[model samples]
Target: MHLYTPHMLLAFLLLCLAGAAFPCSAAPADDGSVLYSTDFTNAEGWITNSKDRFYPEIETGRYHYLLEGGTGGYSAYTLPQKVNGQFTLEFDVTPEKTDDGSSFRFGIGTDKKDSQRGPLLMVELANKKDGRLFYLKTVSKENSLNLVGSSPSTGSSGATVRFEDNTTYHVKLTYYAADSRASIVVQQQGSPDVIFTASAPVSGKIEDLTNLYLTAIGDGTSGPQAEGYIDNIKLTLSPTHAAGDEKDAKNNKGADETPAPVITSAPATPTDEPTPVFTPGPTRTPFPLPPTPTPTQTPKSGLGFLVLLPALAGGAILAMRKYP
Candidate 1:
């Protein structure tokens, strides 16, 4: 049950015409300067108006923004522009659960909907009883949130910061539209210290911000929901701190003078295919060996004996023929 030879049916029709002339995927390039980036792998333009308990989950690869506590769970993503000036946002969180007055908020803003109310910038952390508070705030349509900073903490009110449950942390924000300000930075991924470092000073120009959210304060679903996982989200106008490191960031206070983010290099991916040269196959010139005929002297010495016998016979025949 195996016979197709026409050179195997033309090599199976040239592998089905080279898999229909190559094209397994190559259409994700929008470049409006990438205002949004995702690691959700496929959360498709993100948005979650809580179709039921604020469900956001993109399994094993990470993106599990749940929220329940008094039920104000949120999730958002809108940005292709708006973030007007310098920019850089990073992500890779890991909290996992929260209970006492639960909290968690991510940021980037110009909020949109929930009945209009713009302006935002976040990095909250809450867990009070005076213990796990991390901060940095600014929500305004004319002064609504306004806290503006916190990050060198440990409790006893130096400002607290107790993350440790799935422990992943990497956050990084850097909005500096000529000093309207925004600079928090957290570490914890392969730590050498730095889970805090803060700065805030907003009044306007958060580089013209847009939207990028992830909230989960808790109160209604029995008020106690705040879990986390988020992963790799990124946005960049590059330059997150590397110009003399802003005077070493005024000594970010601990973890050995925190001054971390400076990783740049991303903006090259637009190919149509041009890199395939190989050419090698034509080397074999070895064929010449057929001339050994001198091996025919096999008569050895018998040849001389035969010659003598013929001479004697010829003489006798000549005499007989003359007599006849």
Candidate 2:
């Protein structure tokens, strides 16, 4: 009753053709960026709304954001995906308390149905008992660019973080549509401690990021209205170029990045189709490249060859059937 020995039947026929030559996925690595992740459990594609003493619900996993003690009250979600150039808006807010009055405004600009939305780009986490406006804006009726510190703990480039009460913040906004520029990072979701950071410059080209346009302002004299819970929602769209850090951000996007254009080497047909690139598909983390350890490109071990190819195809179909 012992068979399968031809070097264990060629390692169980390469572990029963190893899941048809190695395949196992949980999905997540199409880094073309224009992504839109969610963990709301359900309520698909979301388009919620509320105003004047706001309250927008979807609560079972999260998306609840009430502000019922207000002045110019509001609540919104209207995000269906429209970001055009570069983007990375992540979200995971949760504040139901910490002496917050209210203001959470997540980003991606101008689209409440656009009657004429002027190029927006937000991150205004404003809560005020006396001070707090964690900044990063990019409006455009003509001009607006507030980065780093808008007030209360400093504003103009870095130093802002007082969002704590029921804490669960993990915001990360990044837009770079070739210098329309943007940056905002706040962490404490799992806690790596980079409280906040900001960057600015965007007075044009914001025709619309369409939506993720979540808001939750409060104005009951700024002290007890803006509550929260805006779970995992993410959006990604910044992976142009042939990868490898966007080809080193396009060879250091010119701040006098000169080796005299690689010693005057003019012969580019848009840089030779990405210099014989091999890391295809918008480059790195459009998910699994066969468990990238990148020796030459793949198969370094592949999870013990995909757990020995289904236990060698269930022991060669139960030692060739007859399980009686």
Q: Top lDDT: which candidate number?
A: 1
Could you give me the TM-score of model 1 versus the true structure? 0.26
Q: Could you report the Cα RMSD, in angstroms, for every candidate shown?
A: 30.7, 19.2
Clashes of each: 14, 14
- Residue lDDT tens for model 2, 137-252: 66654534343443222333222245555777777776666656566666677655555545566656665456655543323444455566778777766555233543344344
Q: Give each model a TM-score.
A: 0.26, 0.26
Q: Where does model 2 exceed 4 Å of error?
A: 1-86, 89-101, 107-122, 127-132, 136-148, 151-172, 175-182, 185-236, 239-324
Tens-place lDDT digits, model 1, residues 53-103: 434464566677666555555777888776666566778878778667666
lDDT on C-alpha atoms for all candidate structures: 0.53, 0.52
Looking at candidate 2, what is the lDDT of residue 158? 22
Give residue 140's error in model 2 in angstroms. 30
Clashes of 1: 14
